[model samples]
Target: MADLVVGVGLRDGVGAAAVVTAVRSAIAEIDASPTDVVALATLDRKAAELAVVRAAAELGVPVLGFTAAELAAASVPNPSARVAAVVGTPSVAEAAAILGSGGGELVARKRARDGVTVALARTV
Candidate 1:
């Protein structure tokens, strides 16, 4: 099986419960387990997000933060103008996942729930 990377985005005040729920949903779509995940990625501004940190700790993976420019440079299937206006990135979860995977193929697009978003990618 291919190694996977998961990228996450969450609204402020989101908790680990919501993050875990969203991540589980995304990985389930690709039949991946926590053990299959190599890392988690998100915007650098959110490096201190407790939800992201907790999720990474729970899954036993490191969390990587990407700059807005790096995330914006990634090609994502779901670009959002609203996100661009707020974070200077069109697609946080998808872009972070793609970039964090080092040009890996996106296996799951953004999956959102309870103010949390998740996407998965696999290195090719």
Candidate 2:
């Protein structure tokens, strides 16, 4: 139950605001606290995406990015228990699939607070 900041990347003029809204809505559907999730929808650009990542890093929140179907390549700053901020192609199904895969162990859950819900999977 680690707080996950999910970022969605879309094409230019793809209504990033709408996408972000949709992401937030989807996050709400996950049945968790709103503050536990930070959804950022942005256009498919390096600088724009980096800014989002930077902000999340500053906040000490684990960042995740969704582009379309697959995850795009980006270097994320690993501060504390912060894993790589996942950047994938924008797709609700894909996003769900990615998240459902048990992304990884909760390295760091909250920076501002403590007692974060951590989710992890063990591979055989």
Candidate 3:
């Protein structure tokens, strides 16, 4: 099985439960498990989001935070101008996943629910 990383983007005040649910659903699409996930990635601005920290703790994985410039450098299938305006990156979930996986392939695009967005990437 491929090693996986999940990137998350969430609105303020989102809870860990919602983050976990969204991640589970995203990885489930690829027939993967939370145990298969190596890390959770997000923009550095969200590095201190309590929900993200809790979700990573629950999944037994590290949380990787990337700067907007670093995330922007990653090539992603989906880029959002709105996100860029708000966070200085066109792609948060997909780009963070790709970067956190060390240039892995994006296996899943961003999936949004309950104000949380999740994307999956796997190292080749």
Per-model C-alpha lDDT, please?
A: 0.88, 0.34, 0.91
lDDT by residue (1-124, candidate 1, tens digit) is 4588888888999998888888878887777777788988999989678888898898888899999999999989999999999889898999989988998999998988999888899966
lDDT of 2: 0.34
Best-to-worst order by TM-score is 3, 1, 2
Kindly list the per-residue Cα lDDT of model 3 for residues 1-124, writing each as its tens digit: 4589899999999999999999999888889888899999999978778999999999999999999999999998989999999999999999989999999888899989999999998975
Model 2 spans with C-alpha error above 4 angstroms: 38-102, 105-124
User: TM-score for all predictions?
Assistant: 0.95, 0.36, 0.96
Note each model's CA RMSD in angstroms: 1.0, 12.5, 0.9
Give the per-residue Cα lDDT of candidate 2 at 114: 20
Candidate 3 weakest ten by summed lDDT: 1-10
The per-residue C-alpha lDDT of model 2 at residue 57 equals 51
Better model by TM-score: candidate 1 vs candidate 2: 1
What candidate 1 gets wrong by more than 4 Å, as runs, is none
Please provide, for model 2 over 1-124, each residue's C-alpha lDDT reduced to its tens digit, 9 standing for 90 to 100: 3445443333323333344444445444555444655333232343255444554454344444344333323222222222223333323222322343344332222121021112211111
Clashing pairs in 3: none
TM-score of 2: 0.36
